[model samples]
Target: MDRFDQLRILTAIVEGGSLSEAARKLNITPSAVSKQLSQLEDRLGVRLFNRTTRKLSLTDEGGVFYERARAILADLAEAEESLASQSGQPRGRLVVDAPVAFGRYCVAPVLGEFLRANPEVHLDLRLNDRLIDPIEEGVDLVIRIGQMKDSALIGRRLSKSRRLVVASPDYLKKKGRPKTPEDLKAHACLLHSLRRPQSEWQFMKEGGGVESLSLAGAFESVDIEVIRVLAIDGLGLAQLPVWLVARDLESGALEEVLSGHLSPDPDIFTLYPSARHLSPKVRSFVDFLVERFGGERAWWATKL
Candidate 1:
């Protein structure tokens, strides 16, 4: 195989975590992947992976090689993308990821306009709540809510939103509105399973201190949409992003409670692997997101 092909195979194996998976991703047979890896290793006089019946792990030397190989491949890809972008049209397969609910309700809806505007670009959008490494997953961009934790990626703030306690009018009427942060404990509070320590809720105190309370209820879900639905069904009160419940609040189907006490949600962000020399396809998409959701134009942010 050529040097670039070897590099691609090696990186794919590491990212895919197995020869078979790498084969699937590369559209090659597992045996071919194995042979290529073996040839590549023999040519280098180094063992690249420590293999076991159930898994594969890179050796220290393999890890070092993998990092350099990744950089070389990235630089090559960027070089090609830079040249192609000089033609002034963004044309390529652009892969993006986002949280399920937000991707469905927010990101997916805007994609049609973007695709129509850039007809040469192919879009592959993946929606999952799991945190994915963009470089490993080959994702061009990711839309994320909550805190920006990954220091490796570059993040552009799309908008800022606050988490607000909301319940159906019927629920509030039956459970009675919670007058204080502590009072939430007495109400049936729908919780998000993904939100750590599911029962612990934080609120901003009126005088600037923070109130942390452990609140529980009948319903809890990993999906924010499910939690929103449960709250609307009067199953329990839910602390949800303002964007998620903007329509409900506007239609009077849900009432916001303790708005003064709810802490701000982490800023919405569109994250990418790098800021420098970004491919036109990625840059255009990021710019599109900013235009759609960034300051003043963010309808969701305005709802609060």
Candidate 2:
């Protein structure tokens, strides 16, 4: 394999934390990845990694080599990006990630327009609710909701959304609508399993303080969509994002309650690695998304 190719493989192996994961990320067979790594180490005449049956750790030499290799790769990427900018077109693979529900309902619907506009750019979109490190995963951009905690990533605010307490018309008819946050305790409140075992729901008070409720229910799910579906089926009350249940609320399938006691609003953001010269692919996509859904332009937010 070429030296640059070997560098990429080594970087992927270190970042992915395993040969198999690196192979998956590179879209190559694990055996080939192992073979290439072995050849690269043999040619260098030094052990680069300490390997066990289940773990791989870099040796001192490997660490130094990896750092230098990463710098070279970054320089190469910057050069390409500079050239692409001069060409005034984005032409490369763009990897993006977003939360499952938001990706499905909000982001995925708008992807066709982006691809049609930039025919030379290949898009790879991955959807999951789990928080992932975009730098480690080699993702070009990530759409995230809620508070962003990583100062290393450069984030641009796209829009804002809040969790709304809602229930199906039939559910409210049967259980009576909650007059306040305190009334939520007497009803079946769908809880997220991923939250603390004693799930707490906080709401804004009438006078500008916060009221927190410890809630339990017969049903709990890790998936927000599942909870939304249950709430739509008249099963229980659910606290869901405005973007997720806007249509249900409009169609009279779900009704919002305790509007005065809504939860804190969380902003949507697009995050990427801080770079000196941003690639056209990343910049174009971020701008496209902002134009389409940023600020007051979000369809779900507008429905309210």
Candidate 3:
């Protein structure tokens, strides 16, 4: 057995928390993963994991080994990056995770240009609304909107997006415009299920305080795009990221409401694992996104 390869497999299992998950990430069969673990344990004469029906936990010995193994792997990665940078070309498979709507409307549109610029780089883009753990998933980078929860990862602020309460002109005409946040209770509000307190909306007060209101809706959806469409069809009021509705606002399909009293702007961020040496591929990709988005005055803002 190659000890180095077995060490990598062992760390993958620990990070993934199950044989099946590790196998999926490594692109190997679960049986193969199990066999490698068994061999490694036999050679070391020490059990690495305490396995239960639902999950796997590290043994005391495993914890010690895992820390050292991770350090060794990080060092190896840094050495590899140093050599790759010397060549001055970004290559290899780069895995990126991004939110669904933003990836579809913004990031995905610019990918072809990135591909053309770096012919040797292979891109693996995964678009999902769920928050992903980059280190656990072996993702090279992730484009995230809103406040970041993971401090262990390094984040580059790409842009800022305002969260605005909006409604179609036809809807406002039919339902009548709400002059205050309290009036939303009487209006048909479209709720985004992914947001916390889905029925409650938050805003900044003119006197410099935060205001929150519980709202009722005729329509609700986990998908932001669906809510935007529902609002456009004159169904209800919807609060959405400016980037998503910038074009709609420009086309006069949607109009901002309570413009000066909406929540604080949420930032767009590109996150990656904190590493000793950043890979050229990750570096190049992040720089390209920053330049494309134009930092504070993003392309989305330009549309508005």
Whole-model lDDT values for every prediction: 0.86, 0.87, 0.86
Can you give the lDDT of residue 127 in candidate 2? 95
Give the per-residue Cα lDDT of candidate 3 at 157. 88
TM-score for each model: 0.72, 0.73, 0.72
lDDT of model number 1 = 0.86
Pick the lDDT winner: 2
Per-model root-mean-square deviation over C-alphas: 5.9, 5.1, 6.2
lDDT by residue (1-304, candidate 2, tens digit) is 7888999999999999999999999999999999999999999999999999989999999999999999999788667767888987997778999988889988888789899999989899999878787888889898988787858889999888678999999999999999988898899999877555537888877688777789878589999899999999999998888889988988999999988777867789999989535789999999998887787654675545
The per-residue C-alpha lDDT of model 2 at residue 295 equals 73
Ordering by lDDT: 2, 3, 1
Backbone clash tally (model 3) = 0
lDDT (0-100) at residue 292 of candidate 1? 80
Worst 10 residues of 2 by lDDT: 295-304
Off by over 4 Å in 3: 1-82, 301-304
